[model samples]
Target: MFTEISADEHDRQLELHGPLTAAVRRLVEAGISTGADSETIRQAQLAVEAIAETLEQQRHDGPRTMRHAVTGRPVVLADPVIGVRNAIAPPLTVQHTESGRCWTEFTLGAPYEGPPGRVHGGICALVLDHILGEVASDGLRQPRFTGTLTLKYLRATPLGRLRAEAWVERIEGIKAFARGQILDDEGVTVEAEGIFIAPAWAREAG
Candidate 1:
């Protein structure tokens, strides 16, 4: 089941309490103390990663998500799509919905820091792709996945909390077009364009 953790708790674990580093240290200690097989140590380490991922999801202020960190398997709960919807960094939450369009909002935090208190470019891509894909999936019998993406970093996205939004712009046959933007308290920092495609397998499934 999915559970939420307060922002304070997340900070304590990731920053103050140092749960992640502590876990890795423990794995090293175990290896030295017991000379355990490499596989055993790896499995234990994987479990720790799972726990951390689950906790991170609980802390994100977006759609709820949970997964087996070790196997990268979704922890099925309310809706199957909910986990995917929430797993992306700065996970998004639906703010508005209507025919041919969907809207969402979310925040980014220190955990996503790239270069001394700024959001990473890869993370920015993840945010844009998720929202664009979500909007593109709205009316299609077969949902879309990113086929190509183009981005422009107009300015640096500051660390701490920030807002982002995306919407579908057009659709032609199996291709979908979408645009997205990231903003801090100051204003817009990044813009994106994406091309999404409905895969043949998905069409068959639908």
Candidate 2:
């Protein structure tokens, strides 16, 4: 089950996190493309070590369940697809509409590039899977695990800002069916469908 936190507290966490995560992401981008001298590389490595040491000194055991530390949301903060603090994430932002649709948008950087400047096909599938699964779970109200996911790539997705939308197609008992699509500036580049099943624990909890 998802933990509960005050909205004000969540906002505070986001405020505190914004600059820190941005700095880390910038460091990651620089590390990926830097053509620094040996001395510069050594200095950077030492700086990273110092940061790691500070983190280790302050570390404490965290929650066992996969939930966002700040928002208490069901989504994992370490997830590569949508984690707010994950440097590897395109860091997709999902917005749930009252009309029962989930919309997401993000820009992919060089780290997510494949086939020249285009986004990787596998990455497209990953993002679709997550969005479809979110729709299946009804915005995490009734948690479900992905059972089957199928995707079709219509065209290569460019490595810049992308958008995706997903919605539940049907639901029967503990099973949910969903459909989604990913789009770039040109148009839809990938389409997907998926079946998700409520895990035994979730069913029992419900």
Candidate 3:
């Protein structure tokens, strides 16, 4: 179910995978937006397919959780919104606080747009969901899954550098109540609140 590795090993793994992820991230945006001719697009497509085939041959057996032995927390290498090793992630770096708050500042480009020049509402939801979940889990010391999430879009979120924050408003026995928001340069764009539930296994461990 999981792989336990030393801190150095994890660092080495990142070194091996980070460059590829970064390259693919650029490739995705370029592939979507390039005004290249058919010939040029054909060449690029061939190159990308070759690269994907090579990597696919070396893929891991299946989904495997990699946990850090020293930190006692699973390494976030493949999270869709924040995974450094995942091409789809904007790779937002979340800063967690002792005060039960978490925030991240990140940039979104043309790929994340929905309405003209605006960030997709769903993308905003994804970012806030992960941020609030992090707050509820307390950095995974207490495993909590999102039970319910509600969002209010005050205005359109522009696609560029943005900041989002979430914090625990209160907690019941097994449910944690949290609220969060996303902001652009001007002000807050989306407001979110969620309930997260700790499963029986987590409670037993606690």
Candidate 4:
């Protein structure tokens, strides 16, 4: 996985010592000197970057976590499940919670850029599966594995920052049904459903 650095860190570094190298300053100055259009473009980009950095810094905790039944909360798992949970844990860049439902909020950066600067649909599915599965089992404790996942892209999810919510709809014997949605500030961009299996090992352990 790539190490995520907050935009605020970039801004803080910029402010604390100014542009570290003359190269950056030179680039900006050159852009400014080129023409009005260039200056306008540069300023616009810089302002956006500055805002992103500031927001990222302010949300240093990463994603926000929510515990709501509608969102499917994660069950507390034991042993190896605990280890995996910890290892694959969402970045401080994203929030996570395991109550009746499970949810986490975080921003994706250039690394996750699929279509230009927007988040890819497949990535959204990946998140939905994990979150929905976790909620299916209630978290580390119950530990449900993904048997099937279906995602519908209602709209393109932007790359910068995003919010996601997931929860279990119901459970039938060994199978758990779950659903989730991803949203930008505007509204929902992706909706998903998942069928998770509670492995025999996990069930036995529990």
Candidate 5:
């Protein structure tokens, strides 16, 4: 489930595609926030269509789980949460991972808004799920899938800079237990706990 690429080749991939992905992220935000007139919006649509077509001219048969040569860590370019190439991701990235813990600092903008200025509840869950799941998986050394995840939204999460972290509480046989929380400047806004399990295939492989 991982595609390993050499350091030089991975850098090449980023150099070629990183800028385009950044532009796409900006475009996505613009699409949600832009107040362009109808004609301008229509023209923009055509231009975006052209860009998509250009990129589609050459394509991978399908997306796959991958790793960056720089980090040598798993990367899912199309992942909805932390995927480097996915425009829709609030684009969370782990800033720290060690001692059975993982953490990240990120901002959720207009595109992720809910309840006027609050971050979407579902989005918060998504963020926690990814972190908790990753921690429970032990950075994929012993990969596991989410068996259950529970979140408690302690307060309305704002649409701006925030921090999230998760850590492995314990592991029992094929299951790993993890806990995580989300915080803003004021402090904890969400708390989460999850159970991650090694699937039958993964258990057998191990």
Candidate 6:
């Protein structure tokens, strides 16, 4: 059974989530870049432990998936890719266009940087895989797993504001073909194509 949450409550949770995630990101960045002494490091470790304990005291008992029926999107607070509460995400804002395309605008900061100022190639591939798979899934009405993803790095993606766009190219039987690209201020930096497969369970859902 799906979990049900009030829309107002969800909005409230999201409002508090933004600053919480920002703090976690700051913690990660500082942990990586700081050159403090051993004593300071020890103090930081203690502070981290205290925070972990506080969170553990009121943790969810199990995993839950929540969706909004109207928008065909997950509840923002529970979404991993763009959840304000999830620290792992760059938390891009993905929107569906009227022309059957998906677009997201976001920035990768210090934590996501590689090659002295560029976004990591693997991360670029990851983002493409997700967006392409989303396009293939047709807004989750027909869920698909990425069978294969191919990416070409046309140029180094700088570690700042960027855009990603994806659309379905074709669909045949259980396979959906999709393509996506990541763009920086200058132009396209990475392009990708993917084949996504709807498994038996997903096909049954549709």
- TM-score winner: 3
Backbone clashes in model 5, listed as residue pairs: none
lDDT of each: 0.63, 0.81, 0.89, 0.61, 0.85, 0.83
For model 2, the superposed segments whose C-alpha errors exceed 4 Å read: 64-75
Q: Can you list the residue pairs that collide in candidate 1?
A: none
- List ranges where model 5 is wrong by over 4 Å: 67-72
Ranking by lDDT: 3, 5, 6, 2, 1, 4
Model 6 lDDT per residue over 57-148, tens place: 99776434566645545564555567677787888777788888999999888888878899988889878887887788876656689999
Residue 63 accuracy (lDDT) in model 4: 28
List ranges where model 3 is wrong by over 4 Å: none
Task: Give the Å shift of residue 92 in candidate 4.
Answer: 6.4
lDDT tens digits by residue: candidate 3, 109-166: 9889999999999999999999999889887667899999999999999989999999
lDDT of 2 by residue, 95-115 (tens): 889988999988888777789
Best by lDDT: 3
Q: Least lDDT summed over 10 consecutive residues: which range in candidate 2?
A: 63-72
Q: Score residue 155 of candidate 6 by CA lDDT.
A: 89
TM-score of 3: 0.94
- Output the better candidate (5/6) by TM-score: 5
| lDDT value, candidate 3, whole model | 0.89
Q: lDDT tens string, model 4, 1-206? A: 12334455434533643322333334444543455676788787898589658756863343222222333432221111121122222231223453587677776654445888687667777677666766776663466788999988988898767777888788898899989988889999999998989888777876
> CA shift at 84, candidate 4, in angstroms?
10
| Deviation from native of the Cα of residue 172 in model 3, angstroms | 0.4
